[model samples]
Target: MEEQRAPGQWWRYGPPWSRYGPPWRGGPDEAEPQHGNRRPWRSTALLTAFVLIGSNFAAHDQPHRVPLDPYARVLLLITSLLLLWRHRYPVPVAFGTATLTLGYLAAGYPYGPVFLVVAVACYSAVVAGHRRAAWASMGLLWTGHALVALWLYRWLPPAGDTRAGLTQEIVIATWVLAIVALSELARVRREQWARERADRAQAARRRADEERLRIARELHDVLAHSISVINVQAGMGLALLDSDPEQARAALTTIKAASKEALGEVRQVLDTLRASGAAPRTPAPGLDRLPELVEQAAAAGLTVEVEGEQPPLPPGADLAAFRIVQEALTNVVRHSGSRHARVVFAHDGDALRLRIDDDGPATGADAGGSGNGLAGMRERAAALGGTIEAGPRPDGGFRVLAVLPSRLKEDQ
Candidate 1:
């Protein structure tokens, strides 16, 4: 269920119907209506202007060979006044105006611009999405106008002036139809714009989700690899504490180095979260740091041989490739029984290829049936429009290979 907002709380953010709000509240949905409680002064002002203009015309020129009387003038004023609440109660206002218009027409007075009020009311109804009510009111208005025109032509008009009355009726009918058509077109355009906004909002949310997933994968790879090395070193240190003091001291040193590196990387991740707009304190770990990663793996009893020629890569692809290598080596150290591994990096025109082969058992965790490390590597590769292949080699070893595009299409 959707959460209900507190009463009067919207005023603190902005007007009740305004889009602006506190950052925590989330943005308003463009597809939803924004009907504020405050009086619609603009509509009131326009109606006031129309009433003044209509009154001036009623006082001077007579329409339909009939002069305006006090009763007809009162009805015209009442119809215009009803429009002040058109936005709040569009159907009621429209009905009220239509009733007053018919009364004015039937009173044997001039057609003193009562149709202007009815037209405005009809437009308000349509804008408020009350299409059926607007159409019904329009029908009632046209029917009333036609009946009044026929009555005038038959009884009130001079015999030779019948053609003039008919022409007046035709003009009024055209005006009413034009107003209805324009209002309907406006409603359709508004609906189309709202739909387009909704689609764009959905697409933005999907992109944000993908970006968050990518960042999570990077954090996972960094933590897993560093912790694995620390765990291994700490275990060796504890085992050699009494029997071989020097060996134990050396293990403790490795543990300290690994923990320090882990802390720095963790700080980098935290910085990324805290200050997205600020420059990073340290650049993301990329191909340049591959040697340090290998050294760390070596200290954890994994003899890793590095072979690669560095090539220029987009920042995203560079970081992803480095993470892929880090995750693969970490898996070898944690799951593979063998201690020797070889990492080969090669550039192939538009793509950067990575191959990590380990002389480990064919059937092991690192052989890549299903593990988070392998999954993370695959995600990184695929995000950069690349692919990963991991399985047990035929010669009783495990191999992980990744090929990443040096420049992503989005980057281009």
Candidate 2:
């Protein structure tokens, strides 16, 4: 006994019984499948040509056979028309057209090119990922053909010869097998291409996310350091405006310089985003600008002292070291209450080490406090296989120490 399929399983295994609802509708959790760039008109034109050719062949080849009645001709036309919707509902269309072709054949209509519609419909089902439906339809079609051949051999005098009948069946079977093989091969190739396209899209998205993170880090380092300096200088200028005109004028000059530098750095970042083919811009700030940074800190009422001999560092290490010092000093100016800060840079064998300490009262900045500056500094150091430690110093103020390889392994 054949097992009966459930209602929901019928749509998966066989053709839909009705076509009243929207063609693309699905359940809330299921998305309707999209057939991109499919040209239904091409299939329609091909099938229409097959119908005409088959009709003419039948008329010429079977002159003694009775002509197809109006109803049989109409059924053939309807089967051909169903090809128009094959791509949208491939399984249903294949089954429907095959059944209609069987009906026309059983009505004793003269043999014609009606099998072309079945072949094309089976191919469409396979391409749409309905392999089970394609195979089932092909089985039914082959069985029907075998039954028709057997009946013709038993009833008709000329087709009754067993040798001729077997030869014809063999030829028909070979043609059907060839069509199924070619369609399955085409379906496999299409699936492989789709997988490759999806993989490429996923990789591109990952690269975009990484680039966004890098740009964010650059912006944070630039703006945080500059804004801290400007804030300190502006506050100093306001305080000394009535007390001492000379010091207030110097403070205003420092604020202007800090703001100008900040604007230039910001413009460089924006230019990189806007113009891909633009000429090379200025190189990033490094330890060479340490003295200017120290001067700016001094002008901001923080007494900063620098000690050590700078070594020839890799470009990545140089930039990392500069940003580390800049962020450390910026925190001192903005968060720490003490005004005295010390920066020490040293090349210890294979590693370059930097330590920035300030004798300021611990103002919660040492406890991983309220910003991304400390996190940014740590990230810069770690990117070059380095480490950074920032916290409150025992019996004193906050301290930051970063160690990095003087030369990267890749450069070596």
1-412, model 1: which lDDT tens digit per residue?
A: 9547888655543455444333555566532245464445456667767775776677576554556656656766777877767877999998888877776665555665567788889998998899888888877877876786675556643333342467877887788788889889989999899999999999999989987887778778878888888878888889989999899898889888888888898888888779967878989888889889888988899898888877778898889888888888888887888899998989888888889999876334432223677888888888778999999899878899899887757647
**Cα misplacement distance, residue 117 of candidate 2 (Å):** 2.4
Can you write out model 2's per-residue Cα lDDT over 1-412, one digit (the tens) per residue? 8448787754442244322224565543343233342336555767777786677678677755446667867887888878877877899988887788776665556668888888889899999999889878877776776786576545643332342378877887887788789889999999999999999999999888877866777888788877787777777789989999888899889889988998998898888888876753988788999998888888788899888888778888998999899889989988899999999888878899899999879564433334888888888888788999999999789999999999768646
Off by over 4 Å in 1: 1-42, 45-49, 63-74, 151-164, 308-310, 347-349, 362-371, 394-397, 407-411
Weakest ten-residue segment in model 2 by summed lDDT: 13-22
TM-score of each: 0.77, 0.77
The candidate maximizing lDDT is 2
Query: What's the count of clashing pairs in each model shown?
Result: 0, 0
lDDT of each: 0.78, 0.79
**Over 4 Å off in model 2, which ranges?**
1-39, 58-73, 104-113, 151-180, 347-351, 364-370, 382-385, 394-396, 408-412
Candidate 2: deviation at residue 147, Å? 3.3
